[model samples]
Target: MPHAVKTFRPALGAGSVLLLVVAYLVVALNARFWGVVFDTTGLAGLHGAKVVAAVAAALFALTLLMLLPLSLRWTFRPGLAVVLLLSAAAAFFIGDYGAVIDRHALASVYATDAREAGEWLSLRMLAFIAAFGALPAALLWWVRIDWRSAPRELWSRLKLSALAFALLAVAAGVAGKDVASLLRNRMELRHIANPFALLAANLSYLDHARDADRPFVRIGTDARRGDVLVPSKRPVVLVLAIGESLRAASLDLNGYTRDTDVDLHPLPIVNFGRVDSCGTNTATSLPCMFSDLGRAAYDDAEAKHRENLVDVIQRAGYEVLWIDNNTGSKGLAARAKELSAAEGADPSRCNADGCHDEVLVDRLKTLLPTIRRDTVIVVHLLGSHGPAYHARYPAGFAVFQPECRTNELQTCSDAQLRNTYDNSVLYTTHVLAEIVSLLGEPSALVNRMPIEALRCRARRGHAGAGACPEPDVSPTAAVDPGIDAAMLFVSDHGESLGENGLYLHGAPYAIAPDEQTHVPMLLWASDRFAARRRLDLDCVRRGADRPLSHDHFFHSVLALADVRTAARKPALDLFAGCAPSR
Candidate 1:
């Protein structure tokens, strides 16, 4: 019995457990951040040592602050579990999107309906959740902690906190100059701080939502159609297609080496080569582009409350409708007669995965005849939306071979990902071509006019002889008796395809890369519409090379619809100088 004597050691104290947890999070769960640091810093000597020290100090400071709240025995286990779970979730998303989860990204996640969110759910995501979130959560629950009384524990933690703060202050003082410069240069490092980034983003989203929930400030109350346009003319149908995640660089229309936009080459499409988006995500850009307030003066709350492009068009006695194949138009289509392809209304163009952009075109064909008045039809396309780019187009349209088949983009090679994205753009070209054909040939309207009449009008200072009436006629009276059609295509935002190790969209607008900000905008107008309005197609083509941004969208759309409002700024309209006014 005496020989069988055993020895027992005390279990780890609460502070020691907290320290271990913090260390595990910093070193193991945050590999993404450390990798970013290593790649970006490019330091391997004493300067690197300073950075390491500074990072360590910052981590320690954070750990100590977190630990202070867990000092109470009642709060310790639950708090630790929550932190671990959140860190794991953050790690999973960082790996999945190759992006830091910011407030806008958080809002997108929240706004995503269950069916839409399911597109991203797969075996890979399930495994990630199990490994990152469930495993750590189970371990935390399984562990036992040795704790002191609340008073003694609080006192001990206060001392530890002070020491941690002192160390952080000393480290900052020692490397203040270098640390400041590093952070300033590599702003993304702030987003890489695990759990903290997630926490900050959640808080920011909550505050933004709270602020937005207030009654919206109304805008565009004075919206009306200009008297220069005849109300009794054959309906002018304007189709405004809002694309998703379409980068300008990938379009052949913009001189991309690939044939991504070959189908659009024969059409009289004016491709704006240099154009910037209002935001890097659909949720932000969709609303901002439609608002009377341009990007510079745009306020989310005010924009939400106001009548948008569709509303203004409706106000001007035009029938407005929104047909969406993407997620509902981020409240932009709320007031209009809205249709969704995802609602099982058109099963041919949709499936469990989602509907293609062509579904909207199909829907539009059915509705076109019903529209008797001047109308604005907005078609929102899920164009090139990722990481399921391959799913965006039909299988036959996957012209780019060896494309990425999975939504887990990181699982595929960069070449495969790009190919998949390009295939989506290729499909977009077909969609646009189909829409153009549906509008009928612009040449048909040209043949309808008498040659002598056109020549006389042109000789009398009218831009187009056949389309324009005599100088004695009022501008409104000069409306073409035939149907006039116009089509405008623009993306909600651009995408990032493995550029600088970043993928997807939703980076903050201020620091977003060109890959995420530069979007494609194309315009097509029937010969009758162009000639009647005296719009010079050559002038528009020349201006295509000029710099433009989403700031032009609001006024350009209004100008296209001939809507008169105080909010219409002629300087911001791309077609302002091209069109002849009374």
Candidate 2:
């Protein structure tokens, strides 16, 4: 309509172009999803670059077909509308897990109080209809207006290069990823590698998603590049309280006003309010956090190529146990212990399909009695994991009510969703406290050393799952000698709830918000570590920015367990490099 519509409109041409764009973009979307999925799981680019090239060829062909229709129609309205709608829809679906989850199936878990599946589907369906289909269609109505002579002799010139232009769109995506990853790092251009780094990331994400069934990386006890371990005097009990879909800004530690963390408020903890994440998805964020690459080297292919804290701790000779409450995608679970499904060997542990995070602690109670030396245990909670926020907690834990009824966040009011999510935070506080209490018991250590507990979030990194809001989180305060030693806590990454249309983590890195990158970190050390080392808890916590990345988590745990590893580095220890006033 903006062009010569009634006279120039070619129905077949318009439809063809639209369809071509849809098919090509789908390929692009799939690639982006893989970039996210495999970056964490280590399943991307396995079949070789040729396979990726093949995918690129197909997408380009479809794009070329799209041009044929566009050239015939010449209005560009259809192509432009398709691009807008699909881009928006893709973001909505990818960022939102509740959108895809079958809600009725969720309710049916307790069949006596089951709700219809359609109700759940309706939430996403209505949202999609309104935002993608309806809004775009309405825009189409306005598109019917006949505008100025926007199409001039430029149109004729465009026709000659149109084929190259259309194909270039797809090729640019492919070249951006390959060229940047291979050459940019060598040239010290990785930080400045504009659209290329972003494209490569999307391509990797798409490749990973397509290969979800493949095994991530083979976890083992061994040394690789940048590995470290050390000796310590106490048994290590790490209560890794992984927040679900958590956005750092929502935390009280990060300056939000809401009291989302019911029990975390009372504890003396170190608060690293400036940490950030590398990637957004659990698959990527989890493993990348556990890797030795730190923030600078955390990338899709390299994530697969590296060793994590679990492997590092194992090399230090500690008995490694992994207790998971969230999906295995987050790198923490993969670092240690048996999967929830593997608990079948001990019927006393978990009897059903899987065990809760608390079950991991329960398993620890059983295992710790026989441990003669130190040990490291990781507890991965399904804290505030969404759509099924109701499932995040047990029946008694629902202190906050009027919870969001369904996972489709779009359906529920913001307050409802907030309340629902905060309940999970309450659960996190309870679990962390429970974990600390368990660690302090005589059974945990032969010497019965008091354990320290610190709460932390990553400074900043990539985004993936929607982040939780811990609005009432407080910053780091003075560390107390009376407190237990070596309390370390930080988020794996920061999150973006819905700033500037950004819903979750996993956006292209350049465009990712500060929320996605900047995280919260906090710590509380025990008197043993404070006194034996003459450690100044308050001063260290106050001026605590020495680039403490997860690379050190691997080394720090080894030092905590008191086991010496050939790969250990003393500088990796937080207390190692400290000096007076400088």
TM-scores of the models, in the order given:
0.88, 0.56
The parts of candidate 1 lying over 4 Å away from their true place are 1-10, 66-75, 212-215, 442-482
Off by over 4 Å in 2: 1-123, 126-202, 205-241, 329-336, 341-357, 399-401, 441-487, 524-539, 545-552, 558-572, 577-582
What would the per-residue lDDT of candidate 1 be over residues 1-582, giving only the tens digit for each residue?
Answer: 468765554467788777777777777777777777777645579888777778777866775675577656787778877777777777876766767767878867877776668878778878876887678767666666777787877777878788788878877888877767777777776776786677778887776666555665555668787755555556788889889899999886676766677557557788899999998888778888988777888766567667777777777788888888887878887877888855655666766678888887777667776667888888888898887898898876766667899888879998899889988987787788778767765322222334333234322221232344533322222334356788999998999998977898987777789989999999999887776566788988888888999989988888777777777888888987777533
Q: What lDDT is reached at residue 464 by model 2?
A: 29
lDDT of 1 at 204: 76
* Best-matching candidate per lDDT: 1
Q: What's the lDDT of the predicted structure labeled candidate 1?
A: 0.76
Local distance difference test scores for all models: 0.76, 0.47
